[model samples]
Target: MDTWRQIIADDEKSWVLFEHGTCVVLTTPGDDLAAQAVSVLRDSGPVHPGTPAADFGTVPLETTPGWVITSHHPDVLTYVSPEEIAQDGDNTPLAAGLYGRSKRDQDAHSLTVIHVEDNRR
Candidate 1:
């Protein structure tokens, strides 16, 4: 299994599952589902009839293109523009788009400029 595509614990005590380039947030409070998902993911062999725990929550069999699991709380990635910047005290457009680390990161203070494509239709 690809490391990036594997289900991992979100920095904010939730489960983060990735399929394709989209991320899925399984809102299993108290990390219950996240733990189970991680166990299943780390186990050897394919996911089958009896692989997942009987009480385990639903596992998506396929990913919907251009779909996002919405949440008010930011995960590992967040988007921002020049208008949201807080340095110059002036509201000028400083960049086309500034990609910055999510505040949740351990050392969260970096920005990179890159072309962003809107996959949503």
Candidate 2:
């Protein structure tokens, strides 16, 4: 098993790429980033393990201060926050389990918790 350190290495800006080229770029060094990525994946849908790769879509990349995520697979659903959607307008149709109400509710709850925690810090 590759430790997070081994996967992240010494790069300040690193990404953990998935089998289908989905990736999470880490812009800071912290275990929290890994947890956040996993949370996002889990909240989105079922996360298959062991079948593909132990690290597939789960590993955290070394990052600095600002990190970004990118995915290439057509099956990958892009999530935009309500605030962002309001500001920029939703460009994609909500269908095929994308932007479903349940997922949105979960995301909203998670975002609220994160917002509270961040404010406390």
Candidate 3:
């Protein structure tokens, strides 16, 4: 039997599960990565099947092409722009599209950018 890596905890309200090889980020619902689908805990604090919190932003790591994950809260944000991810690198794009206007693109096939409607979108 193959072992699966699962993230669960109370302080850890949100989580991003990366595929073993693809580095794809999978989320629960509104998470779109997995179609808002996850094993939800019934009542316990941190049950075997944890409940999925509402996901917001999507951030694509500039370091790798296929490495994409959900952007956590501002304090918990994970993905960083190429400029921030690295500095003084030849591969850095002259026109790094990280800002909203630039619209940094990511590995579309391997990743999922989900934005649930909140009276916005």
Candidate 3 per-residue lDDT, tens place, 1-121, comes to 0111121122223333222211222222243323321222111111122222223244334335312223222222223245443454533332222221112112222333343122112
Which numbered prediction scores highest in TM-score against the true structure?
Answer: 2
- Report the lDDT of model 1 for residue 13: 38
lDDT of each: 0.27, 0.32, 0.26
Candidate 2 lands at a TM-score of 0.24
> What overall lDDT, based on C-alpha atoms, would model 3 receive against the true structure?
0.26
Q: How big is the positional error of residue 82 in model 1, measured in Å on the Cα after superposition?
A: 3.9
Count of residue pairs whose backbone atoms collide, per candidate? 0, 5, 2
lDDT of 2 by residue, 1-84 (tens): 123224345445443433222224444425565455445544443333442211112112343221112222222222323343
In candidate 1, stretches whose alpha carbon ends up further than 4 angstroms from where it belongs are 1-24, 27-75, 86-99, 102-121
Q: For every model shown, what is its TM-score relative to the native structure?
A: 0.19, 0.24, 0.23
| Deviation of model 3 at 45, angstroms | 31
User: Which candidate number maximizes lDDT?
Assistant: 2
RMSD of each: 17.6, 15.8, 14.4
